[model samples]
Target: MKKELTADSAAAAARHARYGTLPERIRFEDMTEEVESAPGGAAASYDPEGSWKSYSCLALDLGL
Candidate 1:
């Protein structure tokens, strides 16, 4: 049988990927450059919550 993916699991995966086993190692210096719209437009941001209580890549794609 195949297993289904859930939002909580996705969020955990994101957090883990950023911090790894040593969450304390997370540093702003290591973060990606802020996203901005155009050359001098407002910058984009990412939520540690992965954008919601349950992260949905589709929703994020639509700018939800």
Candidate 2:
């Protein structure tokens, strides 16, 4: 059989568990919602000066 409790009892149990228990913890405010998006578009997400020459290097090494 399942156990059931009234709202008052449930609240009391919750308060006891939250305050009357052995506990140590830390809490922080959520700052993600206040974050601002990047100033530029997707172009700013990458390094424009970066080069992709790894394939060429690998081909040269393998004599492909």
Candidate 3:
């Protein structure tokens, strides 16, 4: 049986068709383009406790 193609798999196939594949060895210097970073030190001093809030148990509600 043939497997179904997911959205991610389809996108990956399209990308592979367009750009082929990556080289065996990727260098850090090749990816040294300066892109826009997070505002100041927001990423450095991120409060994970405040961000990752607990969610309701969906599995229990669905009786799984």
**lDDT agreement of model 1 with the native:** 0.73
Query: In candidate 2, what residue range of length 10 has the lowest lDDT sum?
Result: 24-33
Cα deviation in Å at residue 30, candidate 1?
A: 29
lDDT by residue (tens digit), candidate 3, 1-64: 9999999999999999999988788689986888887676667777778764555678966989
Candidate 2 regions with alpha-carbon error over 4 angstroms? 21-64
How does model 2 fare in lDDT? 0.73
- 1 or 2, greater by TM-score: 1
Candidate 3 residue 48 C-alpha distance from true site, Å: 59
TM-score of each prediction = 0.30, 0.28, 0.37
Lowest summed-lDDT stretch of 10 residues in model 1?
40-49
lDDT of 1 by residue, 1-64 (tens): 9777799988999999888885367678777687655863433554566657765598788989
Instruction: Report, for every candidate in turn, its global Cα lDDT versus the true structure.
Output: 0.73, 0.73, 0.83
Please list the residue runs of candidate 3 whose C-alpha ends up more than 4 Å from where it truly belongs after superposition: 26-64
True-vs-predicted CA distance for residue 46, candidate 1, Å: 58
Clashing pairs in 1: none
List the candidate 1 regions with Cα displacement exceeding 4 Å: 23-64
Q: For model 2, how does the per-residue alpha-carbon lDDT over 1-64 read when each residue is reduced to its tens digit? A: 9889999999999999888976555455542357677789777767646646433576778888
